[model samples]
Target: MSNSVPMTVEGHRRLQEELKTLIRVERPKVVQDIAEARSHGDLSENAEYDAAKERQGFVEGRIQELNDKIARAQVIDPATIKSDKIVFGATVTVFDVDTEKEATYQIVGEDEADIKHGKISITSPVGKALIGHQVDEEVRIVVPSGVRVYEITRISYT
Candidate 1:
């Protein structure tokens, strides 16, 4: 059985837009390129044909991948979830125990994970450790470097 994919409304919309672009623009362009390449003299000696075929394969694979992800997506609205505890789509403020630095992260799905943007995947080590915890709770997470402790300072949704 496939695990449920939890994603915010914005994330779902982004995926839909990507799929639309691939189908409407990329697919047709790749097909035309392949057809044009095929019209050239010898397929064995044609670099254009090989390149076009490779590009077609890549585009088709991405299209299928996007379709599968969209099909399995379980859209969840952040506003609807109660503010009792930290959960998926929650913006959490944490204080690093070692450095005493403050950082905030919004728990998100794998597809939407962008550390620079502070959108962390719920499946990540830090996110997994923060799940179900409440504000003021101290949590320990194991990173590639080592285990680090973080104290949850605040939680918000937006």
Candidate 2:
């Protein structure tokens, strides 16, 4: 579909796993809780029933969201990519011109962005600036902290 979302293979796998857990485990647990709460006499003053129903709604919504994400996911494998310039699924090392520090980051889809692991969303400012640029190219991007310049030192697909 035209509304497809790009994501790494690992991101897709994680979503699938969460969907499985919600359907196979959480769904049944919530159903049991509702049943037990219903057996406790009057439902008018049953706080447990209300809570269980709320949780069930949340779980069901999450499951549907995960399913939609998985269905629209365009999984891109980094290992199969080959290019001299930066693009989605490329791991790049850049030297900060102002700080004089080097950092590595992988340009990934929005769903796969994890800054803690050095993975950045392709739609992010830095990632967008790096795209289509070759090694040793200086890229200047305006971020929240003002303009920052970086020199691309390396690019790898794997």
> Deviation in angstroms for 36 in model 2?
1.8
Q: How would you encode candidate 1's per-residue C-alpha lDDT over 15-120 as one tens digit per residue?
A: 9999999899988998899899889879999999999899889988998888888889999889888886999999999999999999999999999999999999
Considering every candidate listed, which one attains the maximal lDDT? 2
Encode model 2's per-residue lDDT on 3-33: one tens digit a residue: 8888888888888888999999999999999
Predicted structure 2, TM vs. truth: 0.92
Considering every candidate listed, which one attains the maximal TM-score?
Answer: 1
TM agreement with the true structure for every prediction:
0.96, 0.92
Off by over 4 Å in 1: none
Model 2 spans > 4 angstroms off: none
